[model samples]
Target: MKNLDYAYLGPPGTFSEQAISAYCSKYGGKTHACDSIRDIVETIVKDEVDLGLLPLENSLEGSVNLSLDLLYKHSELKLYREIVLPIAHYLLAAPGVKKEDIKKIYSHPQAIAQSGDYINRHLSEAKIVYTDSTAAAAAEALKHDDRAVIGSIRLADIYQLDVLAENLQGDLPNATRFVLAAKADKDFSDKNHLGNNAESQFKTSIICAPEVNRAGVLHEMLGEFAKKEIDLSRIESRPTRQRLGEYLFYIDLMGSSEDPDLIEALNEVEAMSGYFRLLGSYPKTVIK
Candidate 1:
């Protein structure tokens, strides 16, 4: 694969950093760390990077709404690939600190929530502090022996902290799905070098805004896919923002856009909708 420029969230030790790092290791790319999801998307739109990786969903947190919202807003962006990274939140502290010495805990809200049961069970008395990102929490914890952070194992190494507890998240094998997006015109047909036969395995994503809100209209729109027997991996609605009750439907279906059934079903849905966008058909990445 040709080397490409990539963007992701971080200062280092963030899950986004890990996700993009995995992709770069396989495909060869120069990575740029951005401050937020919006920055990553904007960088791609501005052609500052060849691709940007954004977390789409987590098994524990459900969905990252900002990423979805940006997908809906940016017609120029097309998803080219996806990556699933397993989340392993660790309780980290300065060297020489013990569990009982942790008077305060810091982490991103999602990290804290994923590791909630453990925190409540063992560190209930500690003050919970939320940071903008898990890496930021690790940086904060580096300042004092009394503070601890919940983050990845890499964070402990980056911040020179000790791992007080491993696998603190409530769920075993929790993972987050991340997508690689680029301008719609970017070409990435060179998959043979990456060692994965990509064309055969794909998932198509789309967004549809109904022209009107009527009884059973939503069901009728979905019927097109149901009639074709297309397997939908996800279906969720985000408000249109133009109207209070109106919404745009976001869908992920298991098939390439080239498939006859999927193409026909999407055409039918678009025919009955005022706004429609086929985000992209991307190869399904197997979690390792």
Candidate 2:
């Protein structure tokens, strides 16, 4: 096994950290934790790490805009692979503190947003405080008895806190999709699963923008995919951050970029759209 040093979002206990650990354990690698997603990206860009794991989307919460924005901002980084982790948010507090004693609940905005209905139903009186990361929320809650943090079970265990409530998010089918990114593209020929092509599935992600002063341009852009009968799994628009009204669309399609049909669709979209950027094309992880 080659010694692989991977970067992940952490001080510890963030879902990104857990995903990195799980990925490393399953694929044979060593991991290093970083303070922020930007830090992880910086590590990868600087060649300090082999890969950086980041959360791109959550099933319950929708897109992680910051990650998407960062993807746009950092042109050097590329999506090498992706993985999905089952999400389980817990209400954690210091040992001996009962759930009723909690006056404030702290967590990342995404977590708080996803678990809003549950918080309103159960901890309605509790004030919500947003932290940079879920692990930071747990660390903050550890210092006070009146605060409970909504985070993962791994967070509670790492911080030696008690789980006041398990699966507090209310949504039982919660899951988060993370991307494994690196500065260079990946070649999967040496991977273990190459021998078995039975379950192989690939997905390609791209960012594109439609041309200005063009009527029905968006329709024309999409028509390219429709004409090719390409399956677009997801499509989202984010501000291009260039001008006030300019926007960029992020798309996920169900076939490899190498596929002939997908290639034809992409070429057409590229010719029609003002700009386009291919993030990556890699095997899809089936979340069980």
Question: Top model by TM-score, which number?
Answer: 1
Poorly placed runs, candidate 1 (over 4 Å): 59-63, 192-195
For 1-288, candidate 1 gives per-residue lDDT tens digits of 467888888878888887777766775788898987888988998898888888787732223888998888888999888788888889999999999999999998888988989998999999999988888899899899899999888787788999899889766557888888999998777774232754447899999988888889889998999999998988888988878989899899988899999999999999999999999988856445
Give the least accurate 10-residue stretch of model 2, judged by summed lDDT: 189-198
- Could you give candidate 2's per-residue lDDT for residues 91-190 as a string of tens digits? 8999999989999998988888878888988999999998988888988999899999988888877999998787776754578888877775544455
Residue 225 lDDT in model 2? 84
Residue-level error in angstroms, candidate 1, position 49 = 0.3
The TM-score measured for candidate 2 stands at: 0.86
Tell me which residue pairs clash in candidate 1. Answer: none
